[model samples]
Target: MSKQTQETGGAPKWSGSFGFIMAAAGSAVGMGNLWRFPMLVGESGGGAFVLVYLICIFLVGIPLIIAEISIGRAGGKDAFGSYKALNSKWGGVGILAVITSFIGLSYYAVLGGWVLRYIFVSVTGLPKSSEEFFVSFTSSTGSQIIYYLVFMIITVAIVVMGIQKGIEKSCKVMMPLLIVCLIVIVIRSCTLPGAGEGIRFFLKPDFSKLTPGVFLSALGQVFFSLSLGTGATITYGAYLGKDQNIPKSAASIAFFDTIVAMIAGFAILPAVFAFGFSPESGPSLMFQTLPAVFDEMTGGKIFGVVFFVLVLFAAISTSIAFLEVVVSFAVNTFKVSRAKASVISAALITCLGIPCALSFGIWSDIKIAGRTFFDLGDYLVSNVSLPIGGILACIFIGWVWKSKNAEKEVTNNGRISFKLVNVWSVLIKFILPIVILIIFITSNPWIMNLFK
Candidate 1:
């Protein structure tokens, strides 16, 4: 493989394996970890869900990460370009991934804005009523859009700086700080008087709670948390050098992402239980329930700031990856400069996000197939596009591109030794496709309602 990009006047490679791992881990670590994963653990029978989730991460998530990164390093191009380079017909799968990332980012930025607002709110003072504050903030169209734009600008500026200077550097700073903040919160949360109940609730497994649906939920969480089928791993992998070990690097990404998520649960659920709140609070757990928990804690304001800052870091880290996917596609496909692509893509995403921002306010009544714009967009990306892209990627690697070539990429063509290459091959070729398909089918409200 070449050291610099063949196209785009020699685009730079990742600074080193560590930089690649951080960037990829940043992409993998997002709201899915901070927001969704903890909620899933809360609602899905705690330790049982955690156990299934861990198993899925190894069997399914890690293998998919390996597959996506291998494809990118092998193709040495943008996500779409990489697939098109290898097989013309499989190009659409890359497009599916890219589009999924784009749509995901639209609503994702709105949530980032909410985190920013909450960060300020945390500093100012805790709200008497967390639910009312969240509702008021989200319903204020002007405020929501302004915050959304601010978040977009921040993300765009990072992408505009290019990979090493922007994404990698910011992640290096933010990820460490994020981890520290999590640790601090975990310490405080666990020390609370009634915290052990929540800890046990999160840690103790009841095998009887093991159901097929729990496994499916765990699989979906794995896909969402890892940024699988989103063109992120693939795009980041495009910038990786031949010397970097794909399997090892992918493992690091998965490990960091999973650890952050488990830590987030420790930081969150314990506090929730300590404060006499329900664990199964769903999406509002972070926005609504956590603030109330913070309200009750000693030095809660400081911890609140740290927690939201942690959340913001997670949000921005992932948002930049999402934007990079689109920007890289624009830069590579349209043959535009990085600045031009970044600006245009940022503008497009901002525009597209307008309705999503409005979904909580004036557009609240508007529904697409009984979902608000934000809900519908989230459903499509998470349930529809993500699984399709993942399934197609598995097929492309297993049958079309063939697992052997992908294995060669992961092993760096005999330079590196991967003992689990056969295991990864079998998982990618046979297991992941079936598993992700089940996630897709079970994830959909419409489809699942049919059986109900």
Candidate 2:
């Protein structure tokens, strides 16, 4: 808390816990929840996926979140440095965490570009409907690259402005706007004809669809949606004060994140049902179906504009958080200035993002493990980086680090009785590790199809 401790630490303290919460929430509430969650739900059989996803959030997501935050606060450093500082045995894992963040940001920015493109179209009233706009946009290679560049540039510029002025400021405005817009869209969608059916479809738990494949999908969604294993959470936690309650903060973040996702599902599903369209339209569900639904509504154009803007806000906020992990890692490990780290990280990620930008067009033919360039990037991050990073984090916190130290850091001035600590210990030592390992081994395509 002293000037010497603050200055030597070199990381900016969040203005307050609220700013930190919004920034963290902004990171978690991104394209995955808005664009990907509904599609996954539809594909895995509506309510079944939702049920399993919620279970995963509590079982796996909560413990790992606490571990990550505890580690970050304990180290009081950036992602890689934090891990390395914790113990030398974790240096490689720390570096992998850094790699994961960079890899995630690479393709993430490309998709963020797609959202940016849609935002402009929403403002200009071009393409008319989501379906038409997406078809036209994906039909050409040149346009996708141009739009991708625009998105990356915007992301880099914001990151270049430094954390307080750039990342925190943007989230303060964008997060509130995102919530307000989402509320309006949900209200409108609920009024549509046949909206009841859509709500029923989402809420009804079809226990029959609770297959292992569905479970894995839900697990993956929970991890990806929360931006776990990407070091974003770790870096955000590093900015916290000792008095911040780790468990309470994690629960709040998870609650808001899950609620926003559900709200998005509510907003989109009713409209999809009203339009008699399949909700399993994959990633393009939002881009294609929602616009058509809006087009038929009374204030379609206005809502369409608002929705795309919301998407842009979600994408940008998440991207900024993702970029922050890489920037923080660089600054902490190499002892570099924030400006240098930002530019270097941006340039590196931009180069890595080329294939993702071209995945729909020029590099369309490129395939690995039966996926396109973009798919490969996504798979690498979700299946490889995330699960692995999460596993290592759990092990480090539960086993590697001194238990008394971790317990003190996590509990701080607040009293966490032996019983609660025991429960957390059991989770980290037994439940979480085994589950993560099972998911990692079974995440293979062959194993997945066996369940199908």
TM agreement with the true structure for every prediction: 0.96, 0.91
TM-score, candidate number 1: 0.96
Residues 28-66, candidate 1: write the lDDT tens digits.
Answer: 898768767777786677788888888988888889998
Among all windows of 10 consecutive residues in model 1, the one with the lowest summed lDDT is: 1-10
Candidate 2 deviant stretches above 4 angstroms: 1-8, 39-52, 126-132, 368-370, 413-419, 446-452
Model 1 error, position 2 (Å): 14
| lDDT tens digits, residue span 1-452, model 2 | 22112422566767666667788888899877887776667667777777778888887777777788888887788788788788977878777878887888888887777777766666556555566668678757788777777887787788788656788778889988998999999999899888888887777767777788788778777777787788888888888877667787777788788988888988888888887977764566767766666777778878888898888899888888888898988887788888899888888888888888788777888888789878988889888888888888888887899556677878884464334666777788778878887777777667668778
User: Weakest 10 consecutive residues, lDDT, candidate 2?
Assistant: 1-10
How many pairs collide in each candidate, listed in order?
0, 0
Reference-based lDDT, each prediction? 0.88, 0.79
